[model samples]
Target: MHFAQRIQALEKNVFADMDRAKSQAISKGKKIIDLSLGSSDLPADPEAIATISASLEDPSTYGYLLHHGTLNFRETVGQWYSNRFGVEVDPQREVLTLIGSQEGTAHLPLALLDPGDFALLLDPGYPSHAGGVYLAGGQIYPMPLLAENDFLPVFEDIPSQVLGQAKLMVLSYPHNPTTATASLSFFQEAVNFCRNHGLVLVHDFPYVDIVFEGMTQPPSILQADTQKSLSIEFFTLSKSYNMGGFRIGYAIGNAEIIQALRQVKAVVDFNQYQGILNGAIAALTGEQTTVKKTLARFQSRRDAFIKALNNIGWQVTPPQATMYVWAKLPQTWENKSVEFSTELVAATGVAVSPGAGFGKQGEGYVRFALVHDPHVLELAVEKIAQFLATRT
Candidate 1:
């Protein structure tokens, strides 16, 4: 039996490779300290959990949830967006419930792209962004995010030929892997570029509340495209609200794009369980104290972990947002991110994501997720120090 050609691009996953390595290390009797994935270790807010628990006893929520059934959740999302970003949204037309933001990101391409059309993607971006394009049978033109330019793509560098065939461009910030935050000004420029080029702009905004150092909340793409022209943004409860396991999120933007994605979703699957959306509503409207506490906890871990790395002579710039520390590899391991990560995990039982797994530009770097407690993060660095000493 033969698999479809689309499966070809999905076959070489770096995370899967790392997972096997981690399993081998555990089999060798090493206790693993996993910093490879960004799934938060924090618990969901009690309010959200209680809301879901209550729904389980309500027989009304046990039926299939169609698009119309999600109206209340959509309205809550609209209110949350308005209060947070000061941008008005029509929940009836511009908002769509998603299983998670990843579902929207992965499925939107089917609605936007034709086979062989191009998508302008950030190199070293989240893996699912490229996977979506691949699944849609589209081409990807990676816009390199260089350190010299603050890890934001330079629009002027996108070749005109590539731009001609490109139908969509995806951006995320605070970005994954690199943990780079984009400014409102940068988003304004991106909106202008997309407007001029007739390309749809998609912003994956999973880390909107993960900032540090008293910085303002990251601006939404709608903040720049006030008219919702040629733009859509995806948001998830996973990162900000510690609802990763709940798999609830939403998409908001141009009514047409929202409808298009909704059509694609109709063919894919119905909405997530109504109970989950009810719990998500509780999360969005409930006290934000859990959000604040989660941020403070991650900031503490970031400081402790970065300090430990510097103490071990592996200096790295602390990230401004997201739960990751994107560190350039030491000189000897610069070009061997995958090898370094595999060997380090095998040797020290500390797992981290290899940068190259994200994209070619991600080579020569590694990403450490600050998902563990500060004490565990410090211990992981201590083991890493020993590994580096032996390698050097």
Candidate 2:
């Protein structure tokens, strides 16, 4: 059997590796407390589910779904973006529905790059972001993020030669793994940098609604390029509506980028069945109170978990946004992210995502997903405390 060379550049997946170990532990009678993946433990909005259920009886929606059939979903996306960000959008040209934002991220590369063009990506970025680039045969120039910079990549650091070959600059905030949020001003600066370098700006906005109190609402890349002439931002119902399993999402921004992504998508798969689109439209156009309640739940979990970890002697800062708590590993475990994750899960059954899985620059930190309830989180912390106490 033969496989593509791209398959060799990446391993099966580090998160899956942790899952197998966790499963093995559970099989041996360990009480597994999984925090490895970020799939929401919350239920999908009843309204959205109800909307889908009602649509199923209509045989009209059972046919092949194409772009024309998804117009209403696109219009809802445009209105949602306009209301959320105050940026007027033309749904006809600037919106495209995706099976999930992952579909867009993974497919955009094919439209933007001709094997071997460079993509400037976040160093501790979502794994699939890098995988998408590699699958498209593009070279990656990682923009290493650091704590001192508030986890924002330094625009001045990219080399001049690399800029010319770079066709896209991918960024996400409230970011994954690091839980960092970028200000609109920072986004404006990024927009100017990308414009000056002639690069397409792609923003993965899955965590747009996962922000917490006192922090400003993170801006969409579209807001930075208000004319919708140079950038596109992707949104998913997965994080906000607890609809990860539904796999519905959309892209709103530059007409060119939308068209390019649409071209790639059209060749791959048809638009999602209309019932799912109807549910997503309901998610966007219906009452938004659910978002605030969801935020409150995650915030409570974040506070209790951080406080518990601190009391147990792990000095990690509270994250401002996203569902992750990026904690610097203890001195004993620093730089040994995978080992620490494996040993901790094996010993305590409290599974965490290893930072090394993100990138080499992420070696000293471990990411904890705030998915469990406050009390369960506290229990996980206590188990972690016991493991640390005897971890010599």
Candidate 3:
């Protein structure tokens, strides 16, 4: 009946709690409009799917895939990174395939942090970041991402003592649950800071391509550390290529970090299906039209959803990147994010993520994923308006 202490830390996921609430609502015959998770509703690119379909016929791909089997995918990732960011990567040494960037982010702590070491994490960061550090028995020093600072962590504010014990600093942009993008200048500053502090810089870059409004693409962390001296970045096909279910992503940066993560991965499990890698290769190297189309679709949804919320008097800034709208709660619901989210879903059958689910600093906001089509998003907003009317 006894379980490892680590299991206790993993127990309190707000997303899972919301899922149970949603299931109860659905059971009562309430039609559900879920904007909770960021899982894309878009289909994977046909070419990518076709490539995987073709691979399924190859019996050789059915066997367990080892590290060497991932070389082609790694090379593709390297070339993709080079083409996208002007960073030359040694595929053999620098690239490691992952079962989604989540796998890389979650498994990384084991390689970087020993027991009692500190990880400087952004408050309201992606939940898995904290889970990873906890699993590794690492302490977390949350760096609050304040609105005044554009939701980016102010590194200098980190206590000198905490900084001294911190082994790694985790950053993501456009950040999850916040939809804030960091500038190249900020990344440059982070690089210098981490270099000076002798801490590894980890950037979880799932939203790299989900940008909008003719904005410049988000810069790679490697763009700030061209030598990859103290940095590693994780990228996922889930956001850009609509391959979330396929679970294909990669880690690129410090060769030492990649090797350490790979060693951890080897001990845990072998690589994902080789066919999925083929699909990922097709996604990265194939015509990027699907990627562009995906961006356009999300942009339209973002515009429509923001307009609808504004029409209902819930003013929120349109996000420049990522498929989410992070809105501060109204006065009545400001400090009751979990209750507001649960009650809203119960009353209107519209499910969204309570910001408190992400971290303590997320207390007065909610994150709405723009995964549905514009029409459905507008409908969800209409329902939200009705729910708010009742509250008033």
Per-residue CA lDDT of candidate 1, range 256-358, in tens?
Answer: 9999999999999998888999999898898888899999999999999999999999999989999999999999997899999999999999999999999
Please give the RMSD of candidate 3 to the true structure: 0.8
TM-score, every prediction: 0.99, 0.98, 0.99
lDDT of 2 by residue, 99-134 (tens): 899888888998898898999999888888888888
Residue 93: error of model 3 in Å? 0.5
For model 1, the stretches where C-alpha displacement exceeds 4 angstroms are none
Candidate 1 positional error at 231, Å? 0.5
Worst 10 residues of 3 by lDDT: 6-15
- Model 3 C-alpha lDDT per residue in residues 217-319, reported as the tens digit of each score: 9999999999999999999999899999999999999999999999999999899999999999998999898899999999999999999999998999999
> In terms of lDDT, which candidate is strongest?
1
Candidates in order have lDDT scores of 0.94, 0.90, 0.94
> By TM-score, how accurate is candidate 3?
0.99
